[model samples]
Target: MEQVAEKLGRPDAGDAAMGKAWGIWYGSDSTAKRRDEIAIYSSYRDTSMRVKDVKQIRITSNAFKTQDGLATGANLEDTKLKFPDIKKLSSYLNEKKDTVVVYDAKKEGIGFEFLKGKSISLTVHPVNTAVNDTYLTLHPEWKLIN
Candidate 1:
């Protein structure tokens, strides 16, 4: 945790229980109000940390890109062009009242949460359990795009 904090310059906030996640903010204030430009989360098995997944939000710079060169701020068409195999799983209004589309690359263990016309966030996880088990088990209606 200290190493990550050092590299990311101290997380503005964190949730030790929620998959041991940390929110890294950009710009001044360093609070939730400033917006968590980046979110880092780790999965655990038994007492061991299994894997880490990093998510970025509203990132306009070209510093980060997917394996197919898709980046935040890109439109749905651009995502489809980059990841031809991408599959749309569902769509709903997010807490922000924005229409969010969820896309998944089941084989690649990657998922994207796009807000309306532009890509907003990207999440990568293990294929065996791309999403939280509790949520999946509880809401069987929510299916992954296979």
Candidate 2:
């Protein structure tokens, strides 16, 4: 994709909606372990319209391979997964630097994530699914948009 997110990645900690589409972060590179998928409903991307396929979420990173972010010579410290904070998230979003969407965070779903450098567009239910219920981390910096 031409639009690559800059500040997003596997967060060490925090918190998506469904049918609508929201951003998500993960600590592990792959969704191998207890993968948690969240359904995105409404977001800055698709507005109030609810999408049909809530299972189309995608996750990736530049540090991985010939894809998103991992700049040349970037070490673990640079791409380390840290807990997310609402404030930090707002700051990142405010800067318009790290734009990403994590479509899944539910306890037993396939666990879909858009990573840091990419924006995920999916469908979600705004009334049923809550934003705070699925936070990226408990950290103060990982902010969630309501």
Candidate 3:
């Protein structure tokens, strides 16, 4: 945590808790706001939580791009062009009650979250592991997207 604070400057403490994961957020002040927010997650209160290793990094800005130029705000067609093997993984309603679609390129270890056909965020995970194999929060009511 100190190392991240050193490299990225200070981060705002995330107020919400999701299961056993704790989020540390950056760019959330009035100057940057939520649009430029980046969230880093760490295991919380579990036996393994003591390590505090980064479990997830959530990017909500287009300023950061993948080597192939994928970023937030990209449409499904554009994302498909960059990741031809990407497939609809699942769908869930966010806290806002808006439906979000998750697309995964399993071999690439990257997934894109789309809301209304536009990419809203991207998730990185271990290559070769399905999204279902990760620590991502799951909704019992999740809908499988074809």
The CA lDDT of each predicted structure is 0.55, 0.31, 0.70
Stretch of 10 with least lDDT, candidate 3: 15-24
Which pairs of residues collide in candidate 3?
A: none
Tell me the tens digit of each residue's lDDT in model 3 across 1-146.
55766877756656335443435454545665354667665555466645556655667788889998889999999998888999887788766677998888889888888998899887776688765565545334555544
Model 3 TM-score (2 dp): 0.72
Could you say which candidate leads in lDDT? Answer: 3
Which regions in candidate 1 have their CA more than 4 angstroms from the true location?
27-36, 48-62, 131-146
> Lowest-scoring 10 consecutive residues by lDDT in candidate 1?
131-140
Error in Å for residue 69 of model 3:
1.3
Scored against the true structure, residue 17 in model 1 reaches a CA lDDT of 54
What candidate 3 gets wrong by more than 4 Å, as runs, is 15-20, 26-34, 43-50, 136-146
Q: RMSD, each candidate, Å?
A: 6.1, 14.6, 4.3
Per-residue lDDT value at 121 in model 3: 83
How does residue 11 of candidate 3 score in lDDT? 64
Per-residue lDDT of 29 in model 1 = 38
lDDT of 1 by residue, 1-146 (tens): 44556787876654555564445445453553324255555434435555543432223233568776777778878877766677887776544555667776656666677766877666665664443321222113433333
